[model samples]
Target chain A: MRKTKNSVSYNKWGYIFLIPFMTAFIIFQFIPLLNTIYNSFFENYLVGLNQVGPTFIGLDNYKSLISNGDLLIYTRNTLILWVMCFVPQIILSLTLAAWFSDASLKLKGTRFFKTVIYLPNLIMASAFSMLFFTLFSERGPINSILIQLGILSKPFVFFSSTIATRTLIAFMNCMMWFGNTTILLMAGMMGIDGSLFEAAQVDGATSTQVFFKVTLPLLRPILLYVMITSLIGGLQLFDVPQILTNGTGDPMRNTMTLIMFLNNHLYSKNYGMAGALSVMLFIITCILSLIIFKASGHDKRK
Target chain B: MENKKTKGMSVHARRTFSYIILVLVTILCLFWFYVLFINATRSNGELQSGFTFIPSTHLLENWKNLRAGTLPILSGLKNSLIISCSCVLFSVYFSTMTAYAIHAYDFKLKKFIYPFILAIMMIPTQVTALGFVKLVDAVSIFRDSPVPLIATTIAAPVTFFYMKQYMESTLPLSLIEAARIDGSNEFRTFNSIVLPLMKPAIAVQAIFTFVNNWNNYFVPALVLKSDDKQTLPILIARLRSADFLKFDMGQVYVMIAFSIFPVVIIYLFLSKYIVSGVALGAVKE
Candidate 1:
């Protein structure tokens, strides 16, 4: 009876404590999610003096999204940039994490190294993007150095070409993220049982063999976590691209990502198209997340 | 003797290699910051001339440009502080309360709510951007009120995840039960007993939320349209995107410095906690 009373009061306190968060969640997150879903099916465009509120036009917006072909270009840009950044980031961070986590490779000043590497991760992406913009500008130091080095007769304008612009963005992203991934990977590695490494060594395993056979398998869950989060963040490629291009996604709109495009759509008051793009983005992310969850999660279950 | 010598040589080679890699990486990571600092003190003429690793004497001049308020740097700082600090407070405090409620109590929806919150983590605010802006604009008061910005923290699912994990590992239920037995009220128990115990988690989440909110440009850009209310990121963007001749790299560097100064200070002081906090959050079972 006493225990029952205690639990009853616990339930009441639980509801009380939950009210603030739930209230905000409903007001902010849940409603917006529902609204996005609702808006996606409408025909809303800024035609004249008045803003056209979303009106029901089932399947029209989504249909236009696929037909417009901008979806393909934007999606391609987002994926290509993400892949360019992520491939190098994952490989370098894995090796570093392995090297750092290895007790056998004990080196001093790691605290300093860790802080330095992670420093870029802490800075605002906009600020970092700004830094890169200055560095790679036509008259900036990078171009000057290249000219002085006799690598080019004239300054290689970074933003003047598509490949150069993409590469710069990718390099900046890789530099910022590898440190974070290293820390996470290192922590994941550290959490692995020491005896597993020892046991592999005892069984005449080379360090390479142990890493491939034991460490990589053990690192899967964390790696997937890092990858998926990176992918999600990578998918919403905005701040850097947005700032770097001054919200123009200029040079013929080459750098414009899905989110940036959606942003533009909203800015132009093409509310229906923006909603449709958002839904598509949401669906893409959900699919990607599910695939990753299955791939890593299946291994764990086995 | 020969085998021992070879083994020792390999170990020594490995350690040296590790140090070289680490040093190289450190230089790579910090090179831009070094550049940012070096250029902050240079004149626009000096900056456009070439890369100079040397610090020029124009920091004070840059400071003058920064405070001239062609862009509202000082007010941006104040607004950012007001926005991010309150954001951190709401994020850490309310997230903790929500986590505590779920962790400590026996409610019907406890099981459901836990995963429900986790599910929301996968939904980035970008997905709801259009509707969020619409809702805010419709409310009129909330349109640029800073309420939506601060209130967004209350539903911080990631912080709740960390705090819940923290509660499980560090905050034993027995202690709460003991407090309850002593006739302390539920809120009192949470306020007096629980919060102090969750200091480390609170500190960790506070730093993350602070940085996230401080650097957040997208939502703030969309919502805070007024020049006076715009944060540093927006201001910095404006500086960058300005007419080419008007782009002052020195002023830009100083503004960048000014924008991140508080964050750097906070991180420097709480870095040890920040590192551990990330580890605690990342490697959780």
Candidate 2:
């Protein structure tokens, strides 16, 4: 009966509105993606002062990249920094989310605290990195304060040590993101069936028991989603580490992430290797996503 | 009776203790912004040795230094505003229109088209950076232009998803039907009728996109090479890397203070959307 009105002309309007977005998406995203795959196989070498040309070697680019150990170092650094940031971030956010959302605590001024906590994330990472850079610099207030407190005998360089640099990046990342994680986790908690918590409490479960048994289990899907997003974002870490260290990832490149490594290769005019690196990133992302998809309970959306 | 009263008193004490602790933590979280503000007000020499909770009086001097510096802060701010505002405008407007189309009308390739866009979200930005740069060079018409960077805003999957979620609930077919009955064309109905209704969603997304693009150092750092073309974050990063003799910490702090001003002001007015916005993104997932 409804098929008469839902005819071809009626549907023509959708395509007209959709054409602009589709044009942009295809040009910017889809074509480039295909270009990335096509370009990944060719090797470009400089033949003269300025002339360079692509020679298709068919997997030679990926072969050379894989043979090198720099990829491992980059992956290691990315994972380590991400783990350092994410472990603390998720824990603190969960604690904060649980405490604030719990009725018994009756946390005061939730809105104000939430706003303040999220404030750091809004400020540019360039500012945060610069602020921390100065704060930790020798003769800066941090060093002065440390000496005054007798924590150090004299001035010390925080960037000198790899651990220190990595820790600093990790800390800054956590500081900026935990508030967002808290809000997301709180939203997840809000989605939990209220009667389940009530049933647990009615069965003589303590607050801790209820939280551990009831709330956490229900939050698994949200946690998985958050973790996957963080994994992607964190692996591509560039700005803070780049700006804070003059894009050098200084002190022996301890803080250089996968994106930084990729950017460096691109700048040096090694387009083939850069494309290969991007493809490598894509492969790793797909593998990890599959692992997550399997590990996460197969709760297909209703 | 005394035992019961003492238990009640202890519970009251615990609540008070919790409040004090939470408040303290909140202040600790905000301490850096305060420190940044304070340092922005102090001279380079004063910032060297001493830590002061109270602000000193070098803000005007610092501003003067920023203006006098090699890197043009004001121009950077202007370029950033134009780039970000334009990106946000294009991103949200097109995304909403696309989502509206998906919601309102039936087309042959509709199902395949939307999920394909959603699927792109899984691919990291780095995956496309290499090819995207090559494409820009292949098509570049001008040097130090923000056009290439702005062009990428056209394909914003995240904004599309957010707008899709919004249009699902807020928009109804009957409204479109009524508008059609009144002899409104599709584009007219969208521009006149639908856009007004999407103001709240637009405002929330605009804030998110503005902050993201304004603070974005990735693409802008790549494309905007010339001093005048550089955005605030890039300029600040340069100032930050200045040699000791050349480095005036005062200018860095002041420039940072300037960079943060727009976002902080916007955040203050729209803090409410943030919590709900996160929830919106999460629940749909």
| Fraction of real interface contacts that model 2 preserves | 0.74
Each candidate's DockQ score against the native complex? 0.74, 0.70
Question: Cα lDDT of model 2 overall?
Answer: 0.84
Residue-wise lDDT of candidate 1 within A1-302, one digit each (tens)? 99898779777899899999999999988888788888889998887777786679999999989998999998999899999999999988888888878877777777777776776777888988887888788888888878888887888878868888888888888997887888899999999999999999788676778889999998887988999999999998898888888887766778888889988887787888888888989999999999998887677766
Q: Using TM-score as the measure, which candidate wins?
A: 1
TM-score of the second chain, cand. 2: 0.92
Clashing pairs in 1: none
For model 1, what is the error of residue B189's alpha carbon versus the real structure, in angstroms, after optimal superposition?
0.7
lDDT of 2 by residue, B1-285 (tens): 986686568557757876786788688787877888999999999987578889999999999988998888889989999999999999999889988888888888998988988888788777887777778778756346888777778778899899999999899889988897788888999999998999988988888889999999876776677887899888877877778446788887888889887898888888999767866777767
Model 1 lDDT, residue B99, Cα: 94
lDDT of 2 by residue, A138-250 (tens): 77778888898899998889988899889999999998898888888998998887788788867867667887888888898889888988888897788889877887888
For model 1, what is the error of residue B176's alpha carbon versus the real structure, in angstroms, after optimal superposition? Answer: 1.3
CAPRI-style quality class for the chain A–B interface of candidate 1: medium
Please report the interface RMSD of model 2 to 1 decimal.
Answer: 1.7
